[model samples]
Target: MSVPAHPRVTDVIETPVAAPARPRHRADIEGLRAVAAVLIAVYHIWFGTVSGGVDVFLLLTGFLITGSLVRAMERDGRIAFGAFWTKLVKRLFPAGAVVLGAVLVMTYLFFPRSQWMTVIDDVRAAVLYYGNWHLAAGSVDYMADNSAASAAQHFWSLAVQGQFYLLWPVLITLAGLVAVRLGVRVRRVAFAAVGIVFVVSLAYSLWITAVEPVWAYFDTGARLWELALGGMLALVVHRVDLPGTLRMIAGWLGLAGLVSCGLVIGDSLPYPGFASLWPTVAALLVILAGAGEAANGRFSANRLLGVRPLTWLGGHAYTLFLWHWPVLIVYLELTERVRPSLTGGLMVLASSFAAALFTTRVIEGSVNRVTKRHRAPSWSLAAGVIFIVPVLAAGSLWAHSIDQDRRLRLELSSNPLAYPGAAVHLNPELAAGLPDLPIHPDTTTVARETIDQTRSCNAVVEDTEVVSCEFGDPGSDYTIAMVGSSHVRHWFQAMRTLADQHGWRLVTMTKNACQFSSEEQVYRGEVYTECTAWNADVMLELAELTPDAVFTLASLTDRKEDEHVPTGFVDRWRLLDGMGVDVIAIRDTPRFDFPVPECIDRNGRDECSSPKAESMAEVPPFKDLPNVPHNTRFLDLTDSLCEDGVCHGVIGNQLVYYDTDHLSYAFSRSLAVVMEPQLLEAVGQAVPKGEPTLVDAAMTLHESAHS
Candidate 1:
């Protein structure tokens, strides 16, 4: 392919050029590197409290490296793929290995055995370059209901970059080769191809951000354009030159933009799409300002950046990146807190810096020197394979183990309320009279009185198809509706038993994370957009049915510790009251403060075998002071579950909680003895004086169908 002549000289030689006069190392570029590094650290430590600054770093990386790669390819007829791979390894692996090794050792010492298994899994993923996908699948949920996973969660970004690095060079090479075959200038073709990919990827990123923001943020498909922006810069390098004043302006503007991106773009922005352009564009401007004859300018090439400390940091940036996150994670894990104190943060930072320096000096320098001396492509390839293979194997094994453990737990903890044996054992009082009560052959008929009352009182009914008023046996007179988030849904097994025994049709309206609130536009997926519109529509249906009582549970973890009532609970109470439906606020059970799987894996069945009394004593009862003026009654089973101020792990020989916060179906069903009276009191009803009938038996069921 014909190459265009430009004023800038190509710096390549047929043979190794004497490492060309090491141009005065520009302080500004180092400063910019320092800035990128700092932004990432701050964002993760505090602002992951809010936005993803790491994505900005990715964009900056892509722009800088892509520009360098394209310039190299344009200057030389071909890119030395072997050399490129070697440089990448030298840049990334030494520091990465140190971090991974440290995490593994620390994880063994401090983390529970169950968490160790996850560490093994993550390490494997980290090595194999698929950590992002693993994390995405895990979701590492940080919502009120779900807590964040591993401190190593930040490694997911590194994995994304690794994957990109693996594929990008190949893509660039293919594009170059294709351009050479055709009658196009290699630089122009490379530039055009990168530009096209950037636009397409950016478009895809936007679309995916709207539809599947979580995946979009993690997926390479959505992130490639950020890197392409840099490649585009490399191709057009010789054509554009900024004068001194403009260079200064661009440098300042770029720095400002980068900082602003972190400050302004909070967690609310669907990340790594158009919004990411702010940081990326800013990065590009800085890179451009540092290019050409003006590369030695004051702003970018200043002495501040050239100082020993900044230069040392810039040189070890890759190492520092690897070491920082795990240190932060380990610190948080030991403390069991999200926001570390300033002193703690500083300690973590100091430790990470120390580790980075040691790893770079001892490990990275040695590896680079050894690899450069060997210069054997076969050895490099073999080493790469060796490094990656165990990671892949370990990841697969860990994934399998996790799946197996989940299945085993599920099997052992299957909903006991659904088991006939458990039901018989759970309520001997009800079971004793079950044989004497005559079973009604049919009870499908809806009472006319109930139908009339529902139609007159129900205000939110939008569809007749879902809202049905049906009569039970002539003796049956009650109705019940189940409502709330996924946790409420977990109670369906018990709800079904109660509904069937009482001869009342069950009306269920539930959505995951959708608190049954009147407020619209809760955040969903990746964006702060409206929740599933159908959820609101379903609530309207439930309101129309106007059941005798609405049953739902307040999430224990969802409540801020200082606040006794969950925010969702407050919102939901108002909506239910407005609908004129009586509310049964089932108090949430306690969650194990630590990771459940870690405890289980380490302790085996004994991990979950604690008596309910012992468990309840450790976790205090929620003091529910009603915030609403409506007819709400507080139910307290804390005293019943806890004897002598201590809650037992097992209640009636069944595990009280299956995982951390969720009540075991068997345990929940057993609670019928303690709960039945409170339920009656809450509904302002008296229990029949005679032997318990099917209607009375129905009141005893307390298992959850939704979690």
Candidate 2:
């Protein structure tokens, strides 16, 4: 061969072929972002369903960010944590800060003063990138104000994404190092690591989603598998070279599945659990179909996704995501409608698009330009500092002011003359001489007055255990058990007062939105499993404790055209009678379509009052029950709760209710004077005829307030 006229260099030397460079940008992914943002906004506006767009966004984030992180770890053997975080903050925070500032301003202008604190808290949570956890906690909280969605509620997804960005790089770096030590391929190890997270998180998600769906909806741990699924795909995308026909089929199927997911699942099912797989898997299929040579297929989704409109929408997707929720919520508030009208929805969509365009071009463009000019990580860090300081400072200041106001209101409410509460109801003479004092437990603090903060023994919505608390003469031989939903809980102030005076040990077994009943109950259209289980456990506990009497609500009121003793209540009463337990059943209080305190704030007390007939029947509804337990005693406080055929929001210079149906603690405390005698008689305690009455005893407090 050497003798063949000195071999040519090209024939003798074989040059090594270089691997194809990874794509710097993906238009198809951007188009998918557009689809997700639009779906979220539209579904929230009109569908009243969880559109799975949030889940899609989560998966996309993992796909978009994980590959780069893994590659960087493999290339450098370590991640530039500071530089990466700085760049991420620079990219995400500026627009977020602007949105927070806007939300604060809008809350002050458009929302009720009572709602300001919630918005402030949400803003703080969003700023700290813990909004998802905050929302998760609030979802399970009995006292959380959720009359309306907070403007920054959508930031929960952003907060999750922000958290993922912080942790994923470190995880990839760790995996890369571990791979080197184990003599394994980086991609293989990374995929396995992601698989472990996916399995564990998915299992947890399924369990929590079934057990406590409301809480699970916003829990980050329950949502991690969605992101890990994308990470797994990212690790192996280079190898996913599907047949052209298969890819084309996947592309169309994914697009269809993404569009129809919310319609199929709706809000009826617990979400971001196994249900979320529909959208997330669809997103993956689309991503896979567009990978490598598959994207070149004639009927590929790549052609449709690369169209100018979708790409343009994707460019503004982040800002659109930021702007749409606030716009929709504010619109709903302004319109005073729970959901937007057809025309209103269109207007909201247009306004959101316009605002997003402006924000992207002005706010985001300016921040991006500055960050680009200063390529150093330190400049990005400085920009981050600038972005965060104002939000923290402003939120802290606003919260401080509200706290001060709350403290002052709480202090003022302690003076009986300033807040006569139910004293006017106890003695009509006091009502005649009532001064025009400011409402007790001011509108902003009213919702918090349902019960004392120190007393947190009631089982939450998710808990099934028989959580009981003892108050007033816990060491007494005499025992009385208070049981029911929040209806019975709101009467705690009065019950505790009577228990202490009468030397009875008062025990409370209560759950929010759950009455003491054996009948199968439905809450928010799902089986009230916790309530049913709690009721069963409570019944067993009651058998062991053998309380002298069980105090609970006697009737149900819709605050509309209905007020009746439910058959379930009668059944429970009969069961207690069979157990040799006496039952003291108070008639249910009036419910309202609006918060009494908020109504009183917007419209004076008299104007906010409704006809007593709206909530009460001509006769006590329990009296008409077909089967009556001999040991059951019925008591009606309708006279004290309402007067002159009207149920007032504020009576005796006191807000009657903390919320729509829950009585204020101050009002409930004042009712102790009237409730004492009836409660004593029901428990077989002697009610002296000649001695100073409870009404007379309560007058002393009013007299002291005057002095």
For each candidate in the order shown, give its overall lDDT on alpha carbons. 0.58, 0.81
Candidate with maximal lDDT: 2
Per-residue lDDT tens digits of candidate 2, residues 33-89?
A: 999999988888887678888898999888878887776655555667888898888
What residue pairs are clashing in model 2?
Answer: none
Candidate 1 local Cα displacement, residue 492, angstroms: 4.4
User: How close to the true structure is residue 85 of candidate 1, measured as C-alpha lDDT?
Assistant: 75
C-alpha positional error of residue 363 in candidate 1 after TM-score superposition, expressed in Å: 2.5
**Candidate 1 residue-wise lDDT at 26:** 50
TM-score (all chains, Cα) for each model = 0.66, 0.92
Candidate 1 residue runs with Cα over 4 Å from true position: 1-31, 46-56, 68-91, 112-120, 141-149, 206-216, 259-261, 264-270, 273-275, 298-303, 388-483, 492-509, 516-532, 536-660, 664-707
